[model samples]
Target chain A: MSETLTIFTYDWVPKGPRGFVRDLRLRWAAEEAGLAYEIGAVPFEDRQPSHFAHQPFGQVPFLTEGDISIFESGACLLHLAKKSEILMPRTPRGEAETTEWVIAALNSIEMVSVPWWFLGLSGDHENGLSGWLDSRLAHVETVLGGREWLVEGRFTVADLLMADVLRIPQVRARGDRPASEAYIRRALARPAFEKARADQMAHFAAADAKRGEG
Target chain B: MSETLTIFTYDWVPKGPRGFVRDLRLRWAAEEAGLAYEIGAVPFEDRQPSHFAHQPFGQVPFLTEGDISIFESGACLLHLAKKSEILMPRTPRGEAETTEWVIAALNSIEMVSVPWWFLGLSGDHENGLSGWLDSRLAHVETVLGGREWLVEGRFTVADLLMADVLRIPQVRARGDRPASEAYIRRALARPAFEKARADQMAHFAAADAKRGEG
Candidate 1:
């Protein structure tokens, strides 16, 4: 905890993904945990060897604290979760449930929603993955119907990650899941999420002004 | 470590997914760690409320050790990884690398590969996910070309999961990633992996005999 936490993200991105970048996950987690952090930037137009050295996939939202660098937003969030009980309960069962739901958000839910969103870019409303995505969302709706948060009865990193994945505009609009929608609204209304999102938008806007594209 | 470990999976699955069922991930990790464990089965034909209680998605491969139960193959592997250094190094950096790569396999690689394979099931060889899947495979090929294992230059659960994701017949045949293919071959050649696969297949076969469907 002595080392400074740095979250790295692209220097700039288009408006379409301005507020939805994965780095926002790390930002949101830090905000929720009250962890002080700094931001680092990598070129969006030209991914460098240095970037790949930290994140092999050349994706952003890698975290470096002292000498430890971790990539993948989920991994980064888990790393942060370990540093604070506010993000995750310290009990074995509580930690296990939080971790299970975190992986579910990434592997089970986003696994379908992201691809379905990608395929939808082809202007096909009813793509091959549409039904699968709907089924997954329905399953999520069922779970959300019974709980206020994903892991414990209170907010945890699991809820943060799941709400992030579920709040994507395309995924939200795809189905009629009232419980899931309410869950998203509740999660997004958090001050931490609002600050994280606003900060991300402002970060990109500053870059846009520098490039004379603002 | 004193609690008895049990890996839960469906009592039966169709021939198509008999070998590939995710319980193999936990079984393989247990074998690698030389952990004594038992297999628990849920009804595959009729997923009970009990199954949903353990795995909200009603998916197989949930795990129980004593009083704690966790779902998601990635989460189960992680829970096991925490107990044995053989599955994951104890050093901070090593553990971080192992975890980052494990999530990469689950979130980065399998995130796309599973859906791509699912889409390919409709007799469409050139599905919309073809290009995206190829790009992901190529990135993995590049990483594998330079390393013997996914983390710490040695075998870890990360390699176990990544190799499982890549070895899917449809995904492997889709592109020529020599390094990834070699990585899969080396991983699958391990004694633990072989035993895990054979045991899972036999478990399903025993169930088939009970139903007179063998």
Candidate 2:
């Protein structure tokens, strides 16, 4: 929290860490940690060699604090938690519960849903996966239907990771105004959420304007 | 440690957790923790509304620790670590380091590889995922090239979870060399792992034997 941090993100608008959901995750964690940081955006194509060198997978939202580099949205987010007290609660039970949800987001929900959704987005929808997505959406709605978020009391990184994964158009297409879609809208409406969204929008506008002139 | 524990799983097989990874993870942790337990294998087709009611995702290998029902392999393994000192280390930093690999196993290496391997087995490959898997395997090979285990000194739950994820043929296939295969062999040679594999084999054998006799 004492040093000036660099968040290596995507060029143009938000790619991974640059987007509201990804940025907000880091930003909220940073704000909560009281860490002032700068954003350094990397081009989309360059993300593989540039970002993947740091990240085992070719994805965005990698973080560098001095010599330490971390990837995996969950790991980086939890890095914030370990460094900061606000994102993750101080108690053992709280940390354990927070980890439970984090793993759930990656392993249980997002892991399966993201692949299926991405496949569809890429225009190669699987026959079994379509049914699987339907089943997955129903289960998500059932679990998250009544709750305001994945966990209690406040918005944790669980919400941040979950919201972004759910926001993808492929995932959104599953609900058709059911509980999942409603949840995304409600989550996006929060003040922090709005700031995150606007921040991401500004990134895209800058990128688009640059591309247009070129 | 004091009470009899029951683990809900399929007749132990090494593939898909009945015999393969998740069960190995728990039993390994149990061995490390010095706890005695019973295993109950449920049929795969039965994993639907009947068993999935116990676990929403229609997945196998959930745990009933007295009254607390736990799902997800990492959480289950991590939960078991709470009772003792072997599978999980004692310090926060140790746990954090373990948590990163445990997560990386799922999100990075196993995430795409599992699907690609499954497609290879199930006979439907598409969506440019295999290329991504290839790239990811190279990263895994580099990270794991020289190491026998994942973290400091002796084996930890991170290794168990990672071992489980990497045991997939597609992943193991990434390492065509003697060293990589030996790395996997060393991981499998653990007595706890052997027991888990045998259990899964028996489960499959029982099914086959029943069919043959019928």
Best by lDDT: 1
Residue-level lDDT of model 1, residues B1-214, one tens digit each, is 5478989999899999977999999999999999999999999889999999999888979989877999999999999999999999998888888889999999989999999888889888688888888888888898999999988889999999999999899998976788988899999999999999999999999998999998
Q: Model 2, residue A87: what's the lDDT?
A: 70
Give the candidate number with the greatest TM-score. 1
Q: Tens digits of per-residue lDDT for model 2 on A1-214?
A: 4355666556764344345435556654565456677776766755556565666555556677764566667777777777765577766556655666677778876666766755666676664356656776677777676677765567676676677667876567654646777778876676666665676667667887888832
What digit string (tens of lDDT, one per residue) describes model 1 on residues A39-68?
A: 999999999999999988889989999889
What is the per-residue lDDT of model 2 for residues B53-104, given as tens digits with 9 covering 90 to 100?
A: 5566767567775545566777677777767767867775566566667878
Off by over 4 Å in 1: none
**Which pairs, if any, clash in model 1?**
none
Query: Residue A136 deviation, candidate 2, in Å?
Result: 1.5
Question: What is the DockQ score of candidate 1, to 2 decimals?
Answer: 0.82
**lDDT (C-alpha) at residue B168 in model 1:** 94
